[model samples]
Structure formats: structure tokens, C-alpha cells
Target: MSSRSVIIDNTDAQVQYSPGWQANGSPNEYKRTTSNTETQGASFTLKFVGTSVAVYGTLDIVTLPNTTYVLDGGNPFPFSGQPQSQIQYQQVFYTSPSLPYGEHTLVGSCVDGGGRVILDYFVVEIPLEIPTNTSLSTPTSAVPTTLGSKPTPPTTAIVGGVLGGLLFLMTILVAYLWYRQFRDPGRRRDTKPSFTSAEQDAQTRPFNAPAMASSSYITTQHDAETPNHYSETPRHRDVISTVERHKSPHVSLQWNQSQQPPSYSM
Candidate 1:
């Protein structure tokens, strides 16, 4: 689907030069190195892998002569001679015809002994094609499928249940305390003391003692009548007795009684 070119340096090629030929310089330049041979049969050979291959070198018309090139045991083809005084480096010297894509070889020989030839590099063009499936059947091995595990429930529900039970217990305890505070009679303090039946009767009954007349009553009675003939009326004595009882702290009077007054004798 695609094509690309590759450059091979002169150092990568094979050189067979006679003792009379001279070699110089490195492969980084367009004119990597020069080789001069006064002897014929001096040759340069290059082996490469690609669909097409071309040779590159220097051409000097003043001091260089023509050369011959052959491709894969084919017939020799002579390179064109430069008549004018010109010098060129990294020039395409020869290109082979398009051959099948594989390993190929090219060889160059000095046609004239006096000629100078420079070996620089070679350019190879390669065709790239997308690979296709050669087999028709599918693979028999199966790919394993991974199954996901189910998620587990969290512990929050259990913790919440425990907290809810504690809250219910606390609520019941608070309610019980409230009920006890209002309903328990023993917890209340008495503001008034309770009395016994005998104490109540003693407090309610009056002192039963004979009444003593006041000095004013005695004086009034003496002025009214002689001491020996002073007859005390029962109603008058009762009135005096009531007055005296009210004044005395030891006596108790009852106003609800409807009884006959007692008769007094002087």
C-alpha cells in the first residue's frame, strides 16, 4: 500500500580495487570517498534488498573516465562520459530495471584504467503491502468471561436497630419516672399534723368547773340587797357566769345549748 526509499552508504558496499587505486574520506558526505585506479577490472559491488536499486557517486569529467555496470548477471551497460569540465557528487550513476521484490546485486567496473570513480551510496525503493489473513478457519480456543460478584449490605442497619432499642428503653424509663412523681403519695410532705381521737375530744370539750362571780357582780348584788336577804336569780347568775367564763382562760362556753339555768342560794 505504500513505498519507501532507503540509502545505503559506500562503506556498506563491497569494494575490490587494485593496489594502484587510492581510497579517502568518510561516508557522511555526498562525496563520501574517492577511489582512483589506473588498472582495469577494478570494481565496486553492492548487495541490497528491495524492488529497485540505484548507484550514487561523484562524476568528474576532467580527470574521470566512463564506467560499466551490470545487474544480476545481466549484460553490461556503459555509463555516459562527461565531456565538459564538471564535478558532481552523490549523482545517480546507474539504476537497475524494476525486478521482483527480493535481494539483488549490482556491480561496477572501470572501463578505462586512467579513470577515477567515487563510491558514495546506493538508493533502494521498497514497496510495502498490507498483510492479509492466509487461514480461513476461526480459532478454536475460547476467551474466559469474568463474572462480577454481588455487593453485600452495610452494617448501618444493625447499628441503627441497636440505637433504636436503646432509645425506646430510655423513653420508657423517663415515662416511669414521671408517673412515680405524680402518683406516689408517700413521696409527699404533710403540711398539717394529724391528731388522735382522744386529742380531738380533749380540744373540743369545755372545762367543767364551778363558775366564780366577778367582784363587780358581788358589789352590785350587795348594793341591791342585804347580804343575808340577797336572793340570786337564776337568770342573773347565768348572765354573770357567761361574762366570767368569757374573761377566764380556763373555761370554754357553748352557745348552742338550750338548758334551764341553775338555782343559786346565798
Candidate 2:
């Protein structure tokens, strides 16, 4: 990021000094060339690479005239010399703003009414180290290392697969149910009950009733006022009736009829 000055001798510039111009100074000196010609077109062009450029020359208010400075084919600017009795060498007459970092040309011309134009040298302000395509070394601590040979699959794909499988199973179950409904519309209504008829009757039967009964007898009398005695009592009769009403084919019942028995002795 440091900057340095590049000095170009006036002898190295492309000088177009017309007749009456003098080249009297030494080539190694700062002000190597001088032109006192009053011609309007006496000029010098210098090419250099830098961010900015300045022209170094002798300025004299009594001898030098107003000079024109043109940069990169742009508009020219007039530089009026200050009133001074003595010639000053290495004086910065004009300087340009920071230009692009590349080659550029600057032109200095003397006006017709000007007295003299001295070409001392040129100064170019440039960076000390110009950047190039060379590669820079990176610290090992700043670089990252590979942790594995292959990258793992994303969790979203695995989750999507599980969800897809569950959806497929649900679709199949729903399709099966729809098919069953279409094939047998009344299957739900016709389904067998969990309990059988015998089991239902047993559940409804009285808890104290006998599950089975042996042979039983009954007698009927024509006289309503007289009471008829049977082998089984009235309570046993009621149990027998209940068993006969709800009896299944597995159980057997026998009945006997007889006239009123002879008067029972107390």
C-alpha cells in the first residue's frame, strides 16, 4: 500500500520543439531542455503508468508564458505563471487527479503570446508494489479439512418415505373397506350376534330356576272349589313351566295326567 515517485527526465519525453528552441542543459540535469520560442504549437508528450502525474519545469513570471496542459485527450487547462524575477527549476506547473492504474499520456503546449516553456522532468505517483497474478499462501489454520468420504442423505427424504408408506397402507385399508361395502351392502346388518339364542335365554331366565328337571306330573279337577294335589307343589309347577317354555332340544321333559287323587289324609 505504499506509494513512490517515478521521475522521467525531459530528454526521454517526445519533444516537438520548433525552430528557436534551445537544448542547452545537460541530459543528466533536471531541466535538460528549454524552448524560448513564442510559437503557439511548441509541445511535448510523455507517456507513463501511475495513479496521478505532475509536470516538473522552470517557471518564470517575466520569461515564461501561459502554458496549456492536456491529459488523456481531454480538454486543455491553462496554467498562468506567477510573477518572479528568477527562473525556478523543478517547479510543479500542473498536476492531474488520480487517474486509472494504467498507461496515460500528458501533453504540454506553449501559447503564442507566452514567453518560454521549460521541460524539466515528469513525476508519476505510483504504488510501490504493483499487484500481479501470483498466488498467495494461506495459513493452515484458516483452511477446513474433510470429515467424511460421502455426504449423508437429508432427513426430509427419510421422513417423506415413512409418511408415504403410512399413506399407502391407509389407502389400501380404505380401499378394502370400500370394496367390502360395495360387494355386500348388508354384511354389517347380517353379522351374527356375539351370544347365541340359548345363551340369551339363559341370561333372561330367573336366577333361582333349575337348569334341568326330571319327570313331573300334573292333575286337573272339574270342581273349581276343591283344591287338586299334584306330585309337585305350586312353586315346583311354576319352575317346570318356565323350564318347558325356554327348554332347548338338549333337555327332556315328561308329563303325566291323573284324576284328583283320593282325599289326602292329613
| Top candidate, metric TM-score | 2
> What's the true lDDT of residue 146 in model 1?
18
* TM-score of every prediction relative to native: 0.43, 0.44
Residue 34, candidate 2: C-alpha displacement in angstroms: 4.1
Q: For candidate 1, write residues 144-256 as lDDT tens digits.
A: 11112111223677899999999999999999989987898556686675678669898899877675556345545653675454344444545765776677754444332
Local accuracy of candidate 2 as per-residue lDDT tens digits, 25-99:
533334345444456777777766666777766766567667899999999988867877766655778889987
Q: How many angstroms is residue 174 displaced in model 2 relative to the true structure, after the best TM-score fit?
A: 99
Give the Cα-based TM-score of candidate 2 against the true structure.
0.44
lDDT (Cα atoms) of all candidates against the true structure = 0.61, 0.61
TM-score of 1: 0.43
